[model samples]
Target chain A: MQAYLTLVRRELGGYFNSLTGYVIIASVLLLLGFSFTDMLVKLNATPTYVPLTELFYSSYYFWLILLLTAPIITMRTFALEKFSGTYETLMTAPVGDLQVVLAKFTGTLLFYLLTWLPLLGCMVVVRYYTGEATLLEPRTTLTTYLGILLIGGLYMAFGCFASALTRSQIIAAMIGFALGLTLFLLSLRSYMPAPPTDWGAKVFAYIAVGDHMESFVRGIVDTRPVVFYLTVTGFFLFLTLKVVESRRWK
Target chain B: MIVRPIIEVKNLTKRYAGHTAVSNLTFEVGRGEVVGLLGPNGAGKSTTMRILACFLPATSGTARVAGYDVFAEADQVRRRIGYMPENNPLHLDMRVRDYLRFRARLKGLTRRRSRLRTEVVMERCGLKDVDRKIIGHLSKGYRQRVGLADALVHEPELIILDEPTIGLDPHQIRQVRQLIKDLARNHSVLISTHILSEVEMTCSRVLIMQQGRVLAADTTQNLQQIMSDGGQVIAEIAATTEDLRACWEQMAEVEHFNIAPAEGSYQRCALTPRGSFDLRPLVYEQARLRGWPLRELSRSLHSLEDIFVHVTRAQGDGEGEEGR
Candidate 1:
């Protein structure tokens, strides 16, 4: 327990004490601000749509920012440790590799939340600008936040696995970005062909994180997509743990 | 020596890509013992040390560290062992105290206990003056000392140091040797190094290895005795070469004799003692009777360095295989 916390604290510190953390936050916030203005000002000129009054959904801009920042934030977790020789130190410590992986997962989760905080203002302003008192999209808004967390967790897990695969930070980031993009675009399988009947389309839909997240953003929280996102996160984290353990043997 | 060995390696083997890094190596370190894993480059000493630390798994065989099986309960074994690698890996950007605090927590100390241990270790390693300095700015010697301090703060029973003095200056080397000697009061130490004198001065026993094989394991004194070619006695005699040879051969105390130039009227005779014989008294008596002047006399035995080379080379030659 103490060992896990120690790792978590160090990783959290790494995200804040270094320039990489600031860069990710700045880039994500900038994208969020841009997309919110672009979608609100240009796309909808006439006011024919009725607004709900309560909590505004932070979905549209949130997903875009998460997609871009998740890779940059998580790609260096294990890769930098390996590159700087700290991986050997961490391995030889009394802690198990599984605990180290968990700490990284949890620590990056904290960094992701920190990056998302600046965008919450956009949520409040959207509520104010609509001139709807107590306006909210509870079901869609809640599910969208949940989706963002799950998908971000999934990306970090995938990036953690990639980080474990190599010692170069750049290569780790490239592979992580490539893998996340592939997994995010799994739903596009239907556009390419007939999918060999419905089963192939179902399977592709099952694998695509973006398809599941966007579905939640529309106010429908389906159990299958929720389970799929969680399974991907768990499976990738487990693989990361295995890789870390094998490194000691090699 | 203790009633039981602190560490025992039973037929431990580790292979890598069609090459064996350590081959059925066997040795034991007793409690409170300072043993050196002595060998040249790529001698499998580091491989053996890593296995003992529970960082690397063995290909076959069992190693028990602190009475825990390495593979079956590696975490338990790791908790009881502290390892410092050759590279002296640390977060260069982190302050020294912060690093120690973080490492202490990782070693399973509670928050309060970690801070206390951090303070204790900082003082012990003479790092109090630079506690707030980032590790990158420190000198190589200080960094190495910090590395050892990190290993010590955990208070593990066995501390394995790999190439601890690799890049330090002579003064730092001596200081580290003194520190290791001081540390013998509480922990059993296994030092793997290429410096022979470090072994001679700091280690009580040595496990000499070469090419993935254990050549010898014994105390410094015992290894010297075991590897001694034989004892040689130098004596002064006034007799001529043929006369001295004739007289020395008649005595059962002498095995072989050689007459060589000596100081003044005396000649130097090098005699190989026959099976533990003391020929000094007899030689003096013979010189008294002959009225021949005796010059300086001395006895010589093989030094540790000679025995080290002799044993490692002899092991390689005996096996008819190059070092792995």
Candidate 2:
């Protein structure tokens, strides 16, 4: 358990100590800032969600940003280790694959958290401006935060698993994005007339992080979504562990 | 064989695709013996070291490091072995001490213990002064030392260094070689390299492997026996028709000493000796008797390179030239 935290610290330390994390946070904040005064944010300020809502509406935008930024965080996590030939150094250590994977996962998640919080200026500014005028309940706020966290965790795990699959971070990121998209798209059962349609849909939805992410978007917290996030995170993390172990075989 | 083996292996095989990375390999490293794993490229030294370090599992067979099976008891094996790769793999962004401390923690040390271990390893590896420097900012030699410090921060019983002197200047190489030698006083080491002098200086025994098999696993004395068919002794002298019936006989290395065509009165001759021996001092005494000009007296032996090329070529011809 302590090893897990230390690995997390090491991973997080690797990020903050470099420009990748700062770049990611700068971009996220830049986008947020750009949306605030830009003509697009001013035009799209729907009564339902703020102008920032429209900026974040694509989800795919953040997803795309995540897809781009995540590779930088995770590319070096395993691929660079393999390239620089340090994976052997780490693997040969007394640390288990589980601990190794968990550390990387935690490190990336912490990077996400660090970046995610500063961007929450939206919530803070909303509170400052609207006072009680804002209709965001505590539940909705929690759900939104949980939604981002789950998605971030899922991406980190998937990226980590993909990283273990190869020694190239760019290739791993492509593979990770591909996997996340396929899983996300598979939830549309009606779009496909396949025979295992319902089962496929349910399975895809269960694994579809976005499906779980929608619950938080609706500002509704549910046990199913929590369990779904945990299970997918666990499964991907386990796959990362398996992939790391399988390296010796390769 | 005085048998107190700290590490043991049985028919270890690691096959990749149709080609075996390491094929039916078997060897043992005893406690406190600095064993050098000498082999050419594709001879599977790195593969073998990885398996022992618990970084890789063999396709078949088993290895035990510090009495722990490398596959089934990998965590325990890991707990007992420290490893540095041919390349000094490190997170360059992290401070030197932080990397060592993190490694110590990852090795399952508690907070206080991790700090203590990190300090000890950093101090031992001569990294105390640069503990605050980022690893990337340090020179290659310092980086390599930091890598070694990370390897030893946990104080494992065995250290597996894969070509620990790969890409360093001669001075840096010598420094690290001496460091490895110093390390061997307390910890057993399995140093894999093609450099024979590094082995001869730091190792008590050499394991010359080729084409995924052990070609020779013996002490320097034994390897010299095989590599040198019969040693050649060079004798410099300033006399012709040297009386060598009884004088050269005392030097066991002087198998057949003959006077070459002497320039002036100086006798220049060489002795084709039997079985690894040095006849320089005896030749010096022989020169003094005849008042010979003794300038250069030396014996020639095959270096690790010569030994590797010879043994590997021999093994490869039989194995159909592995990996093309």
Number of the predicted model whose DockQ against the real structure is largest: 2
Per-residue lDDT of model 1, residues B1-324, tens digit only: 336678999999999988999999888898899999999999999889888877788999889987889878888887888789877888887889999988888888888988999999889888999999988899988898789888987788998999999989999988888889988888999999988888989999998888888788889888777655356778887778777878888988788888887767678898887886666778888878877778756666667788778887787686776543
Per-residue CA lDDT of model 1 for A49-108, tens digit only, reads 332211123335554565577778887799998888777678878787788899999998
Model 2 misplacement above 4 A: A38-73, A183-215, A222-228, A248-250, B1-3, B225-229, B233-262, B265-324
For candidate 2, what is the total of clashing residue pairs? Answer: 3
Clashing residue pairs found in predicted model 2: B238-B266, B238-B293, B239-B267
Top candidate on TM-score is: 1
**DockQ of candidates 1 onward, in order?**
0.52, 0.69
Off by over 4 Å in 1: A36-68, A123-142, A190-197, A247-250, B1-3, B227-297, B321-324
TM-score of B chain for each model?
Answer: 0.90, 0.81
Per-model C-alpha lDDT, please? 0.80, 0.76
* DockQ class, candidate 2: medium
Error of 1 at B85 (Å): 1.7
